[model samples]
Target: MGKIKVTQVRSNIKRPQDQKRTLEALGLNGIGQEVEHEATPSILGMVKKVEHLVSVEEA
Candidate 1:
C-alpha cells in the first residue's frame, strides 16, 4: 500500500472533541507536526473528519 503524509496545518483549539481525538489518532500533536500513515480506509476516514485542520500529501 502507498503511504500518506498528514500534516497539522491548524490549531485544534475550539474544535469538537471528536475532531481533537481524530487529530491525535493521526499522530498530530501540534500545529506543523506531521506523520506518515498508510493510505487505508480507516486513516482516510479520520483525515476526512479533520480535513480542514490538516494537509494531506502522498508520500
Candidate 2:
C-alpha cells in the first residue's frame, strides 16, 4: 500500500471527544505534527473523521 502523510493543522480544543481521540490515534498531539502511515482502510477512515483538522498528502 502507498504511504500518506498526515499533518495536524488545527487545534483539537473544543472538538468532540471522538474527534480528539481520532487525532490521537493518528499520533497527532499538536499543530504541525506529522505522521506517515500506510493508506489502509482504517487509517483512511480515521483521517476522514478528522479531515478538517489535518492535511493529507502522498508520501
Candidate 3:
C-alpha cells in the first residue's frame, strides 16, 4: 500500500472523546504534528472519522 502523511491541523480540545482518541491513534498529540502511515483500509477509515481535524496528503 502507498504511504500517506496525516497532519493534525486542528486542536482536539472540546472535541468528542472518540475524536480525541482517533487523533491519538494516528500518533498526533497536537496541531501541526504529522505522521506517516500506510494507506490501508483500516487507517483510511480512522482518518475519515477525524477528517475535519486533520489533513491528509501523499507521503
Rank the models by lDDT, top first. Answer: 2, 3, 1
In order, what lDDT does every prediction score? 0.96, 0.98, 0.96
Candidate 2 per-residue lDDT, tens place, 1-59, comes to: 99999999999999999999999999999999999999999999999999999999999
Query: What is the overall TM-score of model 2 with all chains considered together?
Result: 0.99
Error of 2 at 3 (Å): 0.1
Clashes of each: 0, 0, 0
Cα RMSD (angstroms) for every candidate in the order listed: 0.5, 0.3, 0.4
Top candidate by TM-score: 2
Candidate 2 Cα deviation (angstroms), residue 17: 0.2
lDDT of 3 at 4: 100
C-alpha lDDT of residue 50 in model 3: 98
Task: Compare candidates 1 and 2 on lDDT and give the better one.
Answer: 2
Local accuracy of candidate 1 as per-residue lDDT tens digits, 1-59: 79999999999999999999999888999999999999999999999999999999999
User: Ten-residue segment with the worst summed lDDT in candidate 1?
Assistant: 19-28
Candidate 3 or 2, higher lDDT: 2
Residue 29 lDDT, candidate 2, scale 0-100? 99
Candidate 1 wrongly placed segments (more than 4 Å): none
Per-residue C-alpha lDDT of model 3 across residues 19-51, encoded as one tens digit per residue: 999899999999999999999999999999999
